[model samples]
Target: MKKLLTASAFLTATSLLGMVGNAQAATISALTGYSTMGGASTGMQVRVTFADNTTSTGVWSAVDFYSGAASADGWTLFQSGDTFGNPWTFSNNSSKTISSLFINAIAGSTLFDRTNPNPGTTGSAAGWDFTPVSGSSPTSFTYSNIVNLVGQPAVGDLYAALTINWDSGFSTGSNLSFIADTDSAISVIDPSNPQPVPVPAAFIGIGLAGAFLAKKEISRRQKSHKA
Candidate 1:
């Protein structure tokens, strides 16, 4: 009977885990100050390093990661040694345009620390490769996959002072603001005036002359009729 009960418990646990996996899965990041550029239309791969030395890669919507004012928009990725593990890597292919990316890893809260001295790293089209921001001791260190423009991967080594936490129930992590097209200026045409067709000087002059001649001809005809 004891063995039977044990078996039943295991089966029940397995079923629950399966259901969790099948679900959309909780977010790793919060939606407080969640702001995105380029409509967060692009999708990027987010990889997590598990404690067992195994890793899992999943495609996450760039908009899910929020970046805005330093005081707001901070989210947590994982706990020090949670199920998702520590240390993560983000990669975007040529298909996606990532103009500017800023990652700040701090200790206080799981949310990103834009105000802290350790503003983790900055990623560009060249690659996700970056060093410490000038004069700051960063807890999280990141390396790039390759220095190529075609495909760049930003690998963040969160194996530092801050205790990494992985809450499977969360949407995403940190105060991450990704500007897909920061280098280029987006010029939105005014909807009110989608197209402003300017009248040419010659066309205006021709229109005025025609109106004047028509009025003069009408007056002459009227005078002749009266005579």
Candidate 2:
């Protein structure tokens, strides 16, 4: 709900994540983080972190995303301190079903409305409903309360809990989400960036020192021969 992210001044790319293994302690990672004025966005509106396996030691883990900010980036984009609901779509196999769904937000009972991804035929979900998403096979869910058929739900302090049995362990995989403009794309976060995330400048300095010493050794050898 606070401390949003902004592109320092750049653009990069990666591949969509593939299905994860059913291995215990399978890691759940944020493949890609973006703010799409017209696409699926992933990440937490509030400060979020991970909890140990929801099942047991080394099993399905809980990505506990919670916090109640009076006001957050419910909507809007591009610029300093921007905000949005930030709906997320983790790596899904299209076969595995989310075992459990939990949502407990104190909305502060404030009137709120947000049509982030879309108004999507005004629907509603009780915080306790495990199938808040509806249907067995689901790729995504647009959480909202239909006050007006094409309006955003009025509420804050959003909460949700989901359990998924990834076919494989959480590793490199593909991700998919919607976007508004053609400029948007379906990309993934390559933690294993083929082009390594650059090293520190201090490391570069050390490398330069090594090269200088090597060059000095050769120069001294030439001078010794003349002597």
Clashing pairs counted in every model: 18, 28
Instruction: Report how far residue 197 has shifted in candidate 2, in Å.
Output: 45
Report lDDT (CA) for all predictions: 0.20, 0.20
Model 2 regions more than 4 Å off: 1-89, 92-103, 107-112, 116-227
Q: Report the C-alpha displacement of residue 35, candidate 2, in angstroms.
A: 12
lDDT of 1 by residue, 66-172 (tens): 22111112222221111111112223222222222222221111222111112222321111112111111122222111111112221221111111122231123
lDDT per residue (tens digit) for residues 1-227 in model 2: 22311221001111112111111111111112122222121221221112223321111112222211111112111111111222223332322222212111111111112222231212221111111111122222222221121123323212121222222232223232211110111222111111111111111111233234423533443353356
Worst 10-residue lDDT window, candidate 2 = 126-135
